[model samples]
Target: MVELSQTLLNLPVLICRLRGDVVQVETWISASGKHGHTGDWLVRDYITGETHLRATSSRYLMIDKKTRKLSFLKEAWADQIKPHVLDCHEYPIIMGDNRKLLQILDVDTADYVRTGLSPLWNDLDINQYVNYHIKYISWILEGAPRSFLESHKLSAMTVEYRKECGRESMLHNLSAVSRNGTSATNSTDHFTEDEGIEFDHSLYLQDGSEVLRARTMWMPKSI
Candidate 1:
Protein backbone atom coordinates (compact mmCIF):
# COMPACT_ATOMS: atom_id res chain seq x y z
CA MET A 1 0.00 0.00 0.00
CA VAL A 2 2.88 2.39 0.82
CA GLU A 3 4.58 1.61 -2.46
CA LEU A 4 1.34 2.14 -4.33
CA SER A 5 0.82 5.50 -2.68
CA GLN A 6 4.33 6.71 -3.51
CA THR A 7 3.97 5.51 -7.09
CA LEU A 8 0.72 7.43 -7.37
CA LEU A 9 2.31 10.49 -5.87
CA ASN A 10 4.89 10.52 -8.69
CA LEU A 11 2.33 10.04 -11.45
CA PRO A 12 1.60 12.87 -13.88
CA VAL A 13 -2.12 12.21 -13.78
CA LEU A 14 -2.42 12.45 -10.01
CA ILE A 15 -0.17 15.49 -9.97
CA CYS A 16 -2.44 17.03 -12.59
CA ARG A 17 -5.61 16.24 -10.68
CA LEU A 18 -4.32 17.51 -7.33
CA ARG A 19 -3.35 20.71 -9.14
CA GLY A 20 -6.76 21.02 -10.82
CA ASP A 21 -7.21 24.76 -10.34
CA VAL A 22 -3.46 25.35 -10.23
CA VAL A 23 -0.42 24.86 -12.41
CA GLN A 24 1.36 21.57 -11.78
CA VAL A 25 5.10 21.73 -12.00
CA GLU A 26 7.97 19.83 -10.43
CA THR A 27 11.72 20.38 -10.56
CA TRP A 28 14.65 18.07 -9.84
CA ILE A 29 18.41 18.40 -9.51
CA SER A 30 20.71 15.73 -10.89
CA ALA A 31 23.11 15.05 -8.03
CA SER A 32 26.78 15.32 -8.80
CA GLY A 33 29.38 13.72 -6.55
CA LYS A 34 31.54 15.65 -4.03
CA HIS A 35 34.30 16.72 -6.43
CA GLY A 36 32.73 20.19 -6.63
CA HIS A 37 29.51 21.96 -7.56
CA THR A 38 28.05 21.07 -10.95
CA GLY A 39 24.56 21.57 -12.33
CA ASP A 40 22.40 24.02 -14.25
CA TRP A 41 19.48 26.21 -13.25
CA LEU A 42 16.67 25.04 -15.48
CA VAL A 43 12.93 25.59 -15.20
CA ARG A 44 10.38 24.17 -17.58
CA ASP A 45 6.64 24.24 -17.96
CA TYR A 46 5.88 20.75 -16.63
CA ILE A 47 3.02 19.70 -18.88
CA THR A 48 4.52 21.16 -22.04
CA GLY A 49 8.14 20.36 -21.14
CA GLU A 50 9.01 23.76 -22.56
CA THR A 51 12.13 25.27 -21.06
CA HIS A 52 11.42 28.74 -19.70
CA LEU A 53 14.84 29.58 -18.41
CA ARG A 54 18.32 28.06 -18.57
CA ALA A 55 21.44 29.68 -17.18
CA THR A 56 25.12 28.91 -16.70
CA SER A 57 28.10 30.37 -14.87
CA SER A 58 30.68 28.93 -17.24
CA ARG A 59 32.92 31.26 -19.23
CA TYR A 60 32.52 30.90 -22.96
CA LEU A 61 34.14 32.00 -26.17
CA MET A 62 31.85 33.22 -28.91
CA ILE A 63 32.91 33.28 -32.55
CA ASP A 64 31.55 35.63 -35.17
CA LYS A 65 30.45 33.22 -37.86
CA LYS A 66 31.19 35.59 -40.74
CA THR A 67 34.42 37.15 -39.39
CA ARG A 68 35.69 33.97 -37.73
CA LYS A 69 36.91 36.15 -34.84
CA LEU A 70 36.47 34.85 -31.30
CA SER A 71 35.72 36.86 -28.18
CA PHE A 72 35.86 35.56 -24.63
CA LEU A 73 33.10 36.50 -22.21
CA LYS A 74 34.26 35.97 -18.63
CA GLU A 75 30.99 36.92 -16.99
CA ALA A 76 28.31 34.31 -16.43
CA TRP A 77 25.09 34.41 -18.43
CA ALA A 78 21.45 33.97 -17.45
CA ASP A 79 19.22 34.13 -20.50
CA GLN A 80 15.48 34.85 -20.39
CA ILE A 81 15.24 35.40 -16.64
CA LYS A 82 16.66 38.74 -15.52
CA PRO A 83 13.70 40.80 -16.67
CA HIS A 84 11.40 38.77 -14.42
CA VAL A 85 13.10 39.81 -11.21
CA LEU A 86 10.76 42.03 -9.22
CA ASP A 87 12.88 42.52 -6.12
CA CYS A 88 16.08 41.37 -4.42
CA HIS A 89 16.64 39.74 -1.06
CA GLU A 90 19.58 38.40 0.96
CA TYR A 91 19.97 36.40 4.15
CA PRO A 92 22.40 34.04 5.92
CA ILE A 93 21.92 30.41 6.81
CA ILE A 94 23.92 27.64 8.53
CA MET A 95 24.15 24.47 6.55
CA GLY A 96 24.44 20.97 8.01
CA ASP A 97 28.26 21.19 8.02
CA ASN A 98 28.12 24.42 10.06
CA ARG A 99 29.43 26.37 7.05
CA LYS A 100 27.71 29.68 6.55
CA LEU A 101 25.47 29.73 3.46
CA LEU A 102 24.19 33.05 2.23
CA GLN A 103 20.93 33.10 0.36
CA ILE A 104 20.11 35.72 -2.30
CA LEU A 105 16.57 34.99 -3.31
CA ASP A 106 15.89 37.13 -6.38
CA VAL A 107 12.17 37.59 -6.65
CA ASP A 108 11.55 36.72 -10.28
CA THR A 109 8.31 36.28 -12.18
CA ALA A 110 5.47 38.73 -12.64
CA ASP A 111 2.90 39.48 -9.96
CA TYR A 112 0.40 37.26 -11.72
CA VAL A 113 2.61 34.21 -11.29
CA ARG A 114 2.28 34.66 -7.55
CA THR A 115 -1.51 34.64 -7.93
CA GLY A 116 -1.32 31.34 -9.77
CA LEU A 117 1.13 28.51 -9.20
CA SER A 118 4.29 30.23 -8.04
CA PRO A 119 7.29 29.76 -10.29
CA LEU A 120 9.57 27.06 -8.95
CA TRP A 121 12.94 27.85 -7.39
CA ASN A 122 15.24 24.89 -7.03
CA ASP A 123 18.52 23.03 -7.83
CA LEU A 124 20.88 25.56 -6.26
CA ASP A 125 24.02 24.77 -4.26
CA ILE A 126 24.86 26.34 -0.91
CA ASN A 127 28.30 27.45 -2.14
CA GLN A 128 27.01 28.97 -5.36
CA TYR A 129 24.30 30.70 -3.39
CA VAL A 130 26.90 32.21 -1.06
CA ASN A 131 29.10 33.26 -3.96
CA TYR A 132 26.23 35.15 -5.57
CA HIS A 133 25.24 36.66 -2.25
CA ILE A 134 28.76 37.91 -1.74
CA LYS A 135 28.88 39.41 -5.20
CA TYR A 136 25.52 41.17 -4.85
CA ILE A 137 26.15 42.45 -1.33
CA SER A 138 29.63 43.67 -2.17
CA TRP A 139 28.27 45.64 -5.10
CA ILE A 140 25.28 47.14 -3.29
CA LEU A 141 27.20 48.10 -0.18
CA GLU A 142 29.94 49.88 -2.07
CA GLY A 143 29.82 53.53 -0.99
CA ALA A 144 26.63 53.03 1.02
CA PRO A 145 25.53 55.80 3.35
CA ARG A 146 27.07 55.84 6.84
CA SER A 147 23.74 56.94 8.24
CA PHE A 148 22.09 53.85 6.76
CA LEU A 149 24.66 51.54 8.30
CA GLU A 150 24.27 53.06 11.77
CA SER A 151 20.58 53.89 11.62
CA HIS A 152 19.41 51.08 13.89
CA LYS A 153 22.17 50.56 16.43
CA LEU A 154 23.88 48.46 13.75
CA SER A 155 26.55 47.23 16.15
CA ALA A 156 23.90 45.41 18.13
CA MET A 157 22.25 44.10 14.96
CA THR A 158 25.57 42.74 13.71
CA VAL A 159 26.13 40.96 17.00
CA GLU A 160 22.76 39.23 16.85
CA TYR A 161 23.18 38.40 13.15
CA ARG A 162 26.48 36.64 13.81
CA LYS A 163 24.94 34.51 16.54
CA GLU A 164 22.17 33.35 14.24
CA CYS A 165 24.62 32.49 11.45
CA GLY A 166 25.91 29.59 13.59
CA ARG A 167 28.60 29.30 16.24
CA GLU A 168 31.04 27.46 13.96
CA SER A 169 30.56 29.45 10.79
CA MET A 170 34.01 30.69 9.78
CA LEU A 171 32.72 33.56 7.69
CA HIS A 172 30.55 34.81 10.50
CA ASN A 173 33.53 34.94 12.85
CA LEU A 174 35.76 36.68 10.30
CA SER A 175 32.98 39.15 9.66
CA ALA A 176 32.80 39.75 13.42
CA VAL A 177 36.51 40.46 13.62
CA SER A 178 36.26 42.89 10.73
CA ARG A 179 33.17 44.57 12.12
CA ASN A 180 34.23 45.10 15.73
CA GLY A 181 37.99 44.28 15.84
CA THR A 182 36.93 41.17 17.78
CA SER A 183 33.80 39.08 18.13
CA ALA A 184 30.76 40.75 19.64
CA THR A 185 29.93 37.91 22.05
CA ASN A 186 31.59 35.04 23.91
CA SER A 187 30.08 32.39 21.64
CA THR A 188 31.64 33.86 18.48
CA ASP A 189 34.82 34.96 20.24
CA HIS A 190 36.36 31.65 19.13
CA PHE A 191 36.75 33.18 15.67
CA THR A 192 39.37 35.56 17.07
CA GLU A 193 43.15 35.03 16.79
CA ASP A 194 43.22 34.10 20.48
CA GLU A 195 40.84 31.22 19.65
CA GLY A 196 42.62 30.37 16.37
CA ILE A 197 40.00 31.01 13.68
CA GLU A 198 41.07 30.25 10.13
CA PHE A 199 40.19 32.92 7.54
CA ASP A 200 41.40 31.37 4.29
CA HIS A 201 38.63 30.78 1.74
CA SER A 202 39.13 29.53 -1.82
CA LEU A 203 36.63 28.58 -4.48
CA TYR A 204 37.06 26.69 -7.73
CA LEU A 205 36.41 28.47 -10.98
CA GLN A 206 33.25 27.66 -12.88
CA ASP A 207 34.96 25.16 -15.18
CA GLY A 208 36.81 23.66 -12.20
CA SER A 209 40.15 24.43 -13.86
CA GLU A 210 41.34 27.08 -11.41
CA VAL A 211 40.77 28.26 -7.85
CA LEU A 212 40.58 31.83 -6.59
CA ARG A 213 40.46 33.37 -3.12
CA ALA A 214 37.22 35.25 -2.43
CA ARG A 215 37.55 38.88 -1.24
CA THR A 216 33.98 39.61 -0.11
CA MET A 217 33.64 37.53 3.04
CA TRP A 218 33.37 40.68 5.11
CA MET A 219 30.10 42.57 5.22
CA PRO A 220 29.44 46.31 4.97
CA LYS A 221 30.00 48.29 8.18
CA SER A 222 26.38 49.37 8.28
CA ILE A 223 25.09 45.83 7.82
Candidate 2:
Protein backbone atom coordinates (compact mmCIF):
# COMPACT_ATOMS: atom_id res chain seq x y z
CA MET A 1 0.00 0.00 0.00
CA VAL A 2 2.97 2.29 0.54
CA GLU A 3 4.39 3.11 -2.87
CA LEU A 4 7.64 5.11 -3.06
CA SER A 5 6.59 8.44 -4.56
CA GLN A 6 8.61 10.80 -6.70
CA THR A 7 10.80 12.56 -4.18
CA LEU A 8 12.22 9.25 -2.86
CA LEU A 9 12.08 7.35 -6.11
CA ASN A 10 13.84 9.93 -8.28
CA LEU A 11 16.48 11.11 -5.86
CA PRO A 12 19.93 10.03 -7.00
CA VAL A 13 20.94 6.70 -5.41
CA LEU A 14 24.32 4.98 -5.26
CA ILE A 15 25.44 1.40 -4.62
CA CYS A 16 22.56 0.18 -2.43
CA ARG A 17 22.69 -3.13 -0.61
CA LEU A 18 19.69 -4.72 1.08
CA ARG A 19 20.81 -7.08 3.78
CA GLY A 20 17.85 -8.70 5.46
CA ASP A 21 16.02 -5.51 6.48
CA VAL A 22 19.00 -3.19 6.20
CA VAL A 23 18.94 -1.23 2.97
CA GLN A 24 21.62 1.26 1.95
CA VAL A 25 22.25 2.79 -1.48
CA GLU A 26 25.48 4.50 -2.39
CA THR A 27 25.63 6.80 -5.42
CA TRP A 28 29.00 7.85 -6.85
CA ILE A 29 28.08 8.41 -10.45
CA SER A 30 29.39 11.33 -12.43
CA ALA A 31 27.74 14.54 -11.25
CA SER A 32 27.84 15.90 -14.79
CA GLY A 33 25.06 13.46 -15.63
CA LYS A 34 22.65 16.01 -14.22
CA HIS A 35 23.06 18.22 -17.25
CA GLY A 36 23.66 15.75 -20.07
CA HIS A 37 22.37 12.41 -18.77
CA THR A 38 21.82 12.37 -15.05
CA GLY A 39 22.47 8.80 -14.00
CA ASP A 40 20.24 7.34 -11.27
CA TRP A 41 19.87 4.01 -9.49
CA LEU A 42 16.36 3.02 -8.41
CA VAL A 43 16.64 0.03 -6.08
CA ARG A 44 13.27 -1.68 -6.02
CA ASP A 45 14.35 -4.85 -4.29
CA TYR A 46 17.27 -7.23 -3.86
CA ILE A 47 17.63 -10.96 -3.26
CA THR A 48 20.77 -13.03 -2.67
CA GLY A 49 23.09 -10.19 -3.64
CA GLU A 50 21.21 -9.65 -6.88
CA THR A 51 19.00 -6.79 -7.92
CA HIS A 52 15.38 -7.90 -8.28
CA LEU A 53 13.68 -4.89 -9.80
CA ARG A 54 15.57 -1.74 -10.70
CA ALA A 55 15.23 1.26 -12.95
CA THR A 56 17.97 3.51 -14.33
CA SER A 57 17.33 6.54 -16.48
CA SER A 58 19.51 8.98 -18.38
CA ARG A 59 19.05 12.67 -19.14
CA TYR A 60 19.97 13.78 -22.59
CA LEU A 61 18.38 17.19 -22.78
CA MET A 62 15.51 18.98 -21.13
CA ILE A 63 12.12 17.52 -21.81
CA ASP A 64 9.01 19.29 -23.12
CA LYS A 65 6.39 19.80 -20.46
CA LYS A 66 3.46 18.94 -22.70
CA THR A 67 5.12 16.58 -25.16
CA ARG A 68 7.53 14.84 -22.74
CA LYS A 69 10.12 14.50 -25.47
CA LEU A 70 13.86 14.42 -24.87
CA SER A 71 16.41 16.58 -26.71
CA PHE A 72 19.71 15.30 -25.34
CA LEU A 73 20.66 11.56 -25.36
CA LYS A 74 20.38 11.64 -29.14
CA GLU A 75 21.00 15.27 -29.96
CA ALA A 76 24.57 15.02 -28.69
CA TRP A 77 25.76 11.40 -28.38
CA ALA A 78 23.64 9.94 -31.23
CA ASP A 79 23.40 6.06 -31.02
CA GLN A 80 26.64 5.95 -28.95
CA ILE A 81 26.19 2.17 -28.70
CA LYS A 82 25.86 1.19 -25.07
CA PRO A 83 27.84 -1.92 -24.14
CA HIS A 84 26.40 -5.30 -23.22
CA VAL A 85 28.09 -6.05 -19.97
CA LEU A 86 26.88 -6.67 -16.43
CA ASP A 87 29.03 -5.74 -13.49
CA CYS A 88 27.44 -8.82 -12.01
CA HIS A 89 25.05 -11.24 -13.63
CA GLU A 90 21.66 -10.00 -12.43
CA TYR A 91 18.02 -10.13 -13.41
CA PRO A 92 15.04 -7.87 -14.04
CA ILE A 93 16.10 -5.10 -16.42
CA ILE A 94 12.71 -3.46 -16.92
CA MET A 95 13.75 -0.18 -18.51
CA GLY A 96 16.24 1.62 -20.70
CA ASP A 97 18.35 2.28 -17.59
CA ASN A 98 21.57 0.51 -16.64
CA ARG A 99 21.15 -2.42 -14.25
CA LYS A 100 24.65 -2.43 -12.83
CA LEU A 101 25.58 -1.96 -9.15
CA LEU A 102 22.39 -3.54 -7.83
CA GLN A 103 23.10 -5.79 -4.85
CA ILE A 104 21.37 -8.72 -3.22
CA LEU A 105 19.67 -8.59 0.15
CA ASP A 106 21.79 -9.77 3.00
CA VAL A 107 20.07 -12.80 4.47
CA ASP A 108 20.90 -11.77 8.00
CA THR A 109 19.32 -8.34 7.66
CA ALA A 110 16.51 -9.56 5.43
CA ASP A 111 15.02 -11.53 8.27
CA TYR A 112 14.66 -8.39 10.35
CA VAL A 113 13.21 -6.46 7.43
CA ARG A 114 10.78 -9.19 6.44
CA THR A 115 9.39 -9.35 9.96
CA GLY A 116 9.20 -5.59 10.48
CA LEU A 117 5.98 -4.01 11.71
CA SER A 118 3.43 -3.18 9.07
CA PRO A 119 0.96 -0.29 9.14
CA LEU A 120 -1.59 -2.73 7.84
CA TRP A 121 -2.26 -5.37 10.41
CA ASN A 122 -1.78 -9.11 9.79
CA ASP A 123 0.91 -8.78 7.12
CA LEU A 124 2.53 -6.60 4.48
CA ASP A 125 4.98 -6.98 1.65
CA ILE A 126 8.71 -6.37 2.09
CA ASN A 127 8.44 -3.11 0.21
CA GLN A 128 5.62 -1.99 2.48
CA TYR A 129 7.62 -2.80 5.60
CA VAL A 130 10.59 -0.83 4.29
CA ASN A 131 8.26 2.10 3.65
CA TYR A 132 7.05 2.02 7.23
CA HIS A 133 10.62 1.95 8.52
CA ILE A 134 11.51 4.93 6.35
CA LYS A 135 8.54 6.81 7.80
CA TYR A 136 9.42 5.86 11.36
CA ILE A 137 13.10 6.78 10.93
CA SER A 138 12.25 10.03 9.19
CA TRP A 139 9.91 10.89 12.05
CA ILE A 140 12.69 10.31 14.57
CA LEU A 141 15.30 12.34 12.69
CA GLU A 142 12.90 14.94 11.29
CA GLY A 143 15.44 17.77 11.47
CA ALA A 144 19.12 17.30 10.61
CA PRO A 145 20.12 20.24 12.83
CA ARG A 146 18.67 18.66 15.95
CA SER A 147 20.33 15.36 15.23
CA PHE A 148 23.76 16.98 14.95
CA LEU A 149 23.47 19.02 18.15
CA GLU A 150 22.31 16.22 20.45
CA SER A 151 24.68 13.63 19.05
CA HIS A 152 27.75 15.86 19.21
CA LYS A 153 26.97 18.39 21.95
CA LEU A 154 29.51 19.02 24.72
CA SER A 155 27.84 17.83 27.94
CA ALA A 156 26.22 14.47 27.04
CA MET A 157 28.91 13.30 24.64
CA THR A 158 31.06 12.03 27.51
CA VAL A 159 28.32 9.80 28.90
CA GLU A 160 28.20 7.73 25.76
CA TYR A 161 31.88 8.09 25.07
CA ARG A 162 32.69 6.66 28.48
CA LYS A 163 30.35 3.69 27.99
CA GLU A 164 32.34 2.76 24.91
CA CYS A 165 35.56 2.78 26.90
CA GLY A 166 36.66 -0.85 26.87
CA ARG A 167 35.38 -4.35 25.91
CA GLU A 168 37.80 -4.52 22.98
CA SER A 169 35.00 -3.34 20.74
CA MET A 170 36.91 -0.67 18.87
CA LEU A 171 38.42 1.92 21.22
CA HIS A 172 37.02 4.97 23.04
CA ASN A 173 33.75 5.30 21.19
CA LEU A 174 30.35 6.68 22.22
CA SER A 175 27.25 5.03 20.90
CA ALA A 176 24.30 7.26 21.73
CA VAL A 177 21.49 6.06 19.53
CA SER A 178 19.17 8.96 18.82
CA ARG A 179 16.75 10.12 16.17
CA ASN A 180 17.74 13.73 15.70
CA GLY A 181 21.18 15.31 16.22
CA THR A 182 21.02 17.41 19.43
CA SER A 183 20.52 16.17 22.96
CA ALA A 184 17.49 16.67 25.20
CA THR A 185 18.93 19.30 27.48
CA ASN A 186 18.49 22.92 28.46
CA SER A 187 20.90 25.35 26.86
CA THR A 188 24.37 25.17 28.48
CA ASP A 189 24.55 28.84 27.61
CA HIS A 190 21.74 31.20 26.47
CA PHE A 191 21.16 29.40 23.22
CA THR A 192 18.29 26.92 22.73
CA GLU A 193 15.06 27.58 24.60
CA ASP A 194 12.76 25.11 22.81
CA GLU A 195 13.01 21.49 21.62
CA GLY A 196 15.25 18.54 22.64
CA ILE A 197 17.31 16.49 20.19
CA GLU A 198 19.02 13.11 19.76
CA PHE A 199 21.33 11.41 17.26
CA ASP A 200 21.87 8.21 15.27
CA HIS A 201 25.54 8.05 16.13
CA SER A 202 27.56 4.85 16.26
CA LEU A 203 30.05 3.70 18.85
CA TYR A 204 33.61 4.88 18.32
CA LEU A 205 36.45 2.63 17.24
CA GLN A 206 39.55 3.05 19.44
CA ASP A 207 42.88 1.27 19.69
CA GLY A 208 44.28 2.82 22.91
CA SER A 209 47.12 4.27 20.92
CA GLU A 210 45.71 7.78 21.28
CA VAL A 211 43.35 9.26 23.87
CA LEU A 212 40.61 11.34 22.17
CA ARG A 213 38.34 13.78 23.99
CA ALA A 214 35.99 16.57 22.85
CA ARG A 215 33.82 19.26 24.45
CA THR A 216 31.68 22.30 23.76
CA MET A 217 33.77 25.34 24.75
CA TRP A 218 34.14 28.90 23.68
CA MET A 219 36.94 29.46 21.22
CA PRO A 220 37.68 32.79 19.52
CA LYS A 221 38.22 32.22 15.81
CA SER A 222 40.89 34.21 13.99
CA ILE A 223 39.75 36.77 11.42
Model 1 lDDT at residue 178: 22
The best candidate in terms of lDDT: 2
Candidate 1, 33-141: lDDT as tens digits: 2211112344455566664443222112243333434433222322322243223221011112212332211113111111111111232233222222333223223
Q: What is candidate 2's lDDT per residue for 22-59, written digit by digit as tens?
A: 43343322222333432344444434344332333232
What is the C-alpha local distance difference test score of each model?
Answer: 0.23, 0.27
In candidate 1, which residue ranges exceed 4 Å CA deviation?
1-26, 31-34, 56-223
Clashes of 2: 31
RMSD of each: 21.7, 20.5
TM-score for each candidate, following the candidate numbering? 0.17, 0.18
lDDT assessment of candidate 2: 0.27
* Model 2 residue 201 lDDT score: 24
